[model samples]
Target: MQPPLPGPAMILHRRVVLSAALAAPPLAAPTLAQAPAPTEAPRTLPARLLPVPRSVSAELQHRIAAPYPANWDHIPPDTAGWRALQAASAAEVDPLLPGLIEALRITVTPTTIAGVPAFDIAPRDMRPDRQGRLLVHLHGGGYVLYPGRAGAGEAMLMAGFAGFRCLSVDYRMPPDHPFPAALDDAIAAWRAVTAQHDPRRLGLFGSSAGGGLLLATLLRARAEGLPPPAAIAPGTPWCDLAGEGDSVNANAYVDNVLVSRTGWLGAAAALYAAGRDLRDPLLSPVNGDLSGFPPAILTSGTRDLLLSDTVRAHRRLRRAGVVADLQVLEGQSHAQFLDPTVPEAREAFNEIGDFLARYLGT
Candidate 1:
């Protein structure tokens, strides 16, 4: 004889019992002695297996097949090791810039703003309406990678695609400078840029660690009485360094880049944070008040580990009465939109360009 399957009545009864239990919840706190052991406190979910969807473009599908780079799994043992890894990553990415620059017809020049290193990017054929507008970009590299010319890739892409002048801030990072250093440089650059351009014509943008930094910069700028940008675009922002998002676990092994927080991602956070509290508004802007923030366009993908972070930030901004737009790519993971070869990448930037143009002045 076989066991009986759950009948509709039984299911209804279960739901009724569960609802009654939920409605009756008003238990007092348990004593420490009565509390369950810490290790046994957390409930576990069954393991899952996911497949890459065919909904995205073929190029993106190929990218999804091999999401991470060769060195994505290697954990650096020391500062020297981290530097070597950074150099290797830069070497791989830097060579492709010249071709992209020529194709996009954008000129990238190294410059300093408020004594901080940066790159000024301008398109040859600028949009007449965007002539007076300026965008300040911050590059994403876990707050430690992509230094010098290597960090200007995203700025070039935006300038070429969006027809706007961009200043990519090559902020100082950890292993030498940590915590407040990058934030300080960003603030200084913001102050200098605002001095030259009208704040109403200025926009801010960045991704991953850069996205997180962009939000932190806004919070710090607000506290310091600095004028806000007309708009902002934070793509796949690592908003919570403490890794408190559901996707952090749900998207584990799902996102090709920044594979898991337990790996290099968490290490980078610890390295950049130094000994500072992870909840500091300057470190994790998600915990900060975003009441007076300007209109924002937050981007993420279904498979991105930071999807939760981006969604949470957008919700927070919306709850604070700000006009917040969210764009979720079909199958991207992490900052895959940075890849110019991907069709969706272009579409993502186009959407961002349109969003910024809506708020920016001529």
Candidate 2:
């Protein structure tokens, strides 16, 4: 026969429950021989093999498939070696500038801003809305490379794409000058530019090491009571010289450009630091207070070695109650967003342009 269904009163009754429990077989105590063994948690993750993602543009995919740089493992032995390396790198990049400049319909003129050498880039056909807006650019080369005109390519690209007049600071680098020299030059340029242009209509941008310097410049400006820009775009910024970011190791070999910090990147950091503390706010702006920084739009890639640096900087800005936007592209490494030919590159510049337009005044 079927048992009676439990009513609310029967279910709530402790005596009825006890009677039912008494009719059931009691559970036997666990024996030592049958006890489950304790399991220790795994301490490490297994290595993963990742393939080039098909989601990105074909051009970007091709870049992702390219082999790592041959000189990725070479560390400069001395100042001369570093200079030679810089020259070699500049040689490879400089030749491409003429075509890019011509195609982009921009002109680059060498000039001095407060005694610091700089490049003035202007689009031939400037947009009406951007006529009074100005942008300061700092070129990236790990603080030892891309001196003089070689560093102006990024400025030219921005001038052409973003349609804003750009001042690219040809900041002094290490071996001959180190530490404060680059920062000093950048500050000098900013002072000169801000004196001429309305700070409310000005913006700052850079990638990698230059991005780090851009943030540092803002910090230094705040300390000196200088006016801040309206907005900033720091893409894939190498803001943590201490190598404390997770992507530094996670994306080591995965990043085609900056393969790992253990390579020349670490050496470059040491050279730039020049015995100073890596965590110094100027040296590594991620550690600095970002309470009053201007609105920032940061960009990074899924495969960028400094992805964590950019992410950390974005989080810090947001935590400080600053308006911050972060864009992480799929399957990119290092400053691949700066590649002029790729659609993603154009998209990146367009996003920065939009952000600047939103913040900068007429």
**Most accurate candidate by lDDT:** 2
* Candidate 1 regions with alpha-carbon error over 4 angstroms: 1-49
Q: Evaluated with TM-score, which candidate comes out highest?
A: 1
lDDT of each: 0.90, 0.90
Q: List RMSD in Å for every model shown.
A: 4.3, 10.7
Task: List ranges where model 2 is wrong by over 4 Å.
Answer: 1-48
Positional deviation of 200 in candidate 1, in angstroms?
0.2
lDDT tens digits by residue: candidate 2, 10-105: 455765456545555352532344323555442366788778888989999899999999989799999999889888878988888889899999
How far off is residue 60 in model 2, in Å? 0.7
**What is the number of backbone collisions in each predicted candidate, taken in the order shown?**
0, 0
**Per-residue CA lDDT of candidate 1, range 105-185, in tens?**
999999999999999999998889779999999999999898888988999989988888999999998888898899999
